[model samples]
Target: METYRGEPAFNLKGLAAMAATLLIWTGFLLSLRSGSQSVLTTTDLALMRFGLPALLFMPLLLLRWPRIRRIRLRHALLLMLGGLPFFYLIALGSHYAPAAHAGALVPGTAPLFVTGLAVVVFGEPLPRQRLVGLGVIVAGVGVLLGSGLVDLASGYWRGHLAFLGASLLWACYTVALRILGIGALEATALLCAGSLAGLLLLLAGGQVDSNLATAGWPLLWPYLLTQGLGAGIVGGFTYGVAIGALGAEKTAALGSITPALAAVAALFLLGEPLSAGGLAGVLTITLGVLLASGLRWPRREVQPAPAREPD
Candidate 1:
């Protein structure tokens, strides 16, 4: 990977990606609130669970129309397969677990999974400092888990496990992006394509059906629009841009921010109380991510690499 010159700037794309991430974080909270409220019906939940992803990604299918002849079947299959478990696990887990717990657990563990995958699959080196940072992050997560906000015996364990499964699946997808060299747009498009396909299969199997009539446009539309636009389109694009700019490892490292952002959104929007332990864990994780990324306070001098010998 090529390193860009100077400090990383908050450019338009970067800003957009961050904004999209924030929106997605907010959307998760909103969805949870909506689920709690009588505002959402079973059908509305169904739409959120599946319909939104399909609608959000519908635009990407058009890319196959003109310039692009045919998407590589193998790549598309990989992306589709990688996304399936994540979508299902998250959708199921959110129903059982608190949004705050889900947010804290899922994104927090993602970077670690990515780091492990990089070492195992890509043979990428992990420096000692980065390993220590990873340890700190793990410790922070342990604190969050031990906070007693979630009940271990009351089926919440299943939800937490689901979120962990989804995190691992997402990590695999992240690694696939690097190994297959899929660009942001292409990867996003393929994920949408795969999601759409999986959703269709589920519907065909009589697992899910269109219930717009019972769902009503009032509740259904907002949920779908928010999830489809915010998480589906914008989230995909911003993440892609970030991946393009920062590479998979660094972009994945930035994922630690998602939980913090979600926590902040919950605090104000949902009036959720934050525990002292949670706050400390969040701060510790943030610091750990910065350290793992090798981002120092002041800019450091770059040492020149040894000259290569002629073959």
Candidate 2:
């Protein structure tokens, strides 16, 4: 790809892609919170997250099936580890923690994890701007959740830990997508297909579909659309493009906006009140994302050679 002197096409594309990912992710948390209150179970949500997308992307998988099959088991496992299991962990974690914890911890931890992994795995520079931005983002999350943390029960910590694990897995996913040179569409299709197998196994093991059974389809349909398509399919592919375009650190750092945006959404739509701390958190996170992403100080991106096909 050709480059401009200050702003480049890739940077612009990455920002657009990252923004879309943030929007979908914020909606995802909102959907999960709504489902927690409604009849949607983890299994129900998991199936939606994987099932429809699997069908939607089936053609891509079919066309690429022969090459996909040739992927080494470890590589396949790494790819699979990114999508379904990451979502499942967050869903499971919510059983113990409040929205504050999930919203704050999971995304807040992801940038740092991504940065660390990028350093160790890809040997990317640990830029000072990134460090400062990560610190600010962490502080923002603290503001967002500090009060909520005081009243946590024993089990909540488990959920907190799970959120941390989810963050780690997400970082791994981002790095793998970039280093492995997987195309956004290709990764989304393969991961969604793999997710289907996991969900089917759970179904075979007697997972209850009580939500789908008892709740009328009307209540669940909207969520299914959002979870199935927005967060499940589009979110993965867009994030992949971002990692490839923006590099892992900046892309992951941009994710800090998710909690702030989610909080803003809850405030307006759900009538949730934000404390002073929450307001500060929203501001801090926004500024942190700006600093981390270098949106203001845009740089020319060095384009990589064409992505190599997995043998």
* Top TM-score prediction, candidate number: 2
Q: Which 10 consecutive positions of candidate 2 have the poorest summed lDDT? A: 1-10
Q: lDDT tens string, model 2, 12-74?
A: 778789889988888887777677767678878887888888998999999977776766566
lDDT tens per residue, model 1, 242-296: 6665556666676766666676677777776667877877787787777666654
Candidate 2 whole-model C-alpha lDDT, 0 to 1: 0.77
User: Model 2 shows how many backbone clashes?
Assistant: 0
Candidate 2 global Cα RMSD = 8.8
For model 2, the superposed segments whose C-alpha errors exceed 4 Å read 1-10, 153-156, 207-210, 296-311
TM-score of 2: 0.87
Cα displacement (Å) at residue 111, model 2: 0.5
- Candidate 1 residue 4 Cα shift, in angstroms, is 18
